[model samples]
Target chain A: MPIIVNLDVMMAKRKISSNELADIVGITAANLSVLKTGKAKAIRFSTLDKICEALDCQPGDILEWQNPAEKT
Target chain B: MWNKHRSLKLSRILVLCFSVMIFMMTFFVPFVADWYEDVSDGMGLIGGSVYVPMMVTLYVCEGLAVWAVAELHILLKNISKGEVFIERNTRCLRCISWACLLAGGVFGVMALWRFLLFLPAFFAVMFGLIMRVLKNVFEQAVEIKSENDFTI
Candidate 1:
């Protein structure tokens, strides 16, 4: 996890709830939660495509990479 | 028709039957030994002189057999429940493999007194090796499965 998911931040900026985003993204709320909480190991391109279309944002807006050593 | 579920059920029943047979054999060890001696024409390897040591070896092997059988039962139970690649099944396989190896070792020692005992000792060791391989396979499968599950 140095690669972080900023899904919640993007969702908040877009004024979209998890349930609503999940509905538009054609995924379950549980999966959306997993993506939002950064627990997902990897994201499918198709899922990312749907999420970006739903949130009107790029993949880069929802994903970030930070150095673990720098965090400490 | 043969099927996976029925096959598993049969394997479970066979394990249960083997356990019961082993339990019953515990009570009949002395008589069975006597009968074996008689059938073998009082072979110097199994008769009165070597009876005590023979009984000791047999009991040790019986203990290992029981341990192996119990582990097998649990392994089968887990497989029946669709939990094949879990950690518990790998532990069960490891235990069963060790039990087989220990029983083989016991038999190998007894084989010093009787050459014929070496056959079972060889088979047991081979069986143990197969189980050990299977345990390794399961460990890898469980790791892969965990990675796959978390990939979403």
Candidate 2:
């Protein structure tokens, strides 16, 4: 529960549209939105590699571990 | 052409109709004295507690067969419409339909095998038919599924 997808924040800082990111990352806009908003149950490493390469960020920049998090 | 699809549906309806008719015939026929006890003799239920339960079970099995046919019709139509692009869903439905028919045929054959002298060869044949129809249903469903998956 504490792990977070910081895709939206990173996208905002990078001035990138979800659609643009999806185009570069080779996935559907809907699936991209699923990953961005943290609704996805799990991420494939291949997808993760594509996303990280497209965003030019470390995996930690996209994923954050937070304390005081309730268990899902 | 009037069509095999329509014929199969008609046959399913007829099976249900005949089951009810047989129950009524067993009920009204005067040679049969007791309602629950004697009906088994006519239906070939033997000395066990199978008479009333068998009649009741025919109704239930036929009811389920009707529902299964309806669902198979929908799945067939789905395959026709290109709606069932997902191979997983299509495959599962095909497997289920096959399973239903397999069980139906096994039970039907068992029924005839048990009551060979008393019951006619018709139920055995009907069960054979259910198996055949279900096989066709599965094949057609899979055919369209493969075609559509390739298209997609």
lDDT of 1 by residue, B1-152 (tens): 99999999999999999999999989988876666555643222443444566688878888998999999999999999899889999999999999989888998887766667788899999999999999999999999887776555
lDDT of 2 by residue, B19-114 (tens): 566556544533332354444343344345544444554554455555555555555565455455445445445544554554455455435424
Error of 1 at A22 (Å): 2.1
lDDT of 2 by residue, A1-72 (tens): 566889999888889999999999888888888777766656777878888898888889898877854443
Where model 1 places Cα greater than 4 Å from the true spot, the runs are A68-72, B35-48
Per-candidate clash tally? 0, 0
Off by over 4 Å in 2: A1-3, A65-72, B1-55, B79-152
- List, residue by residue over A3-66, the lDDT tens digit for candidate 1: 9999999988999999999998888899888888878888889999999999899989989999
TM-score of chain A of each: 0.95, 0.86
True interface contacts reproduced by each model, as a fraction?
A: 0.52, 0.00
For each candidate, the alpha-carbon lDDT, in order, equals 0.85, 0.60
Docking class of 2: incorrect
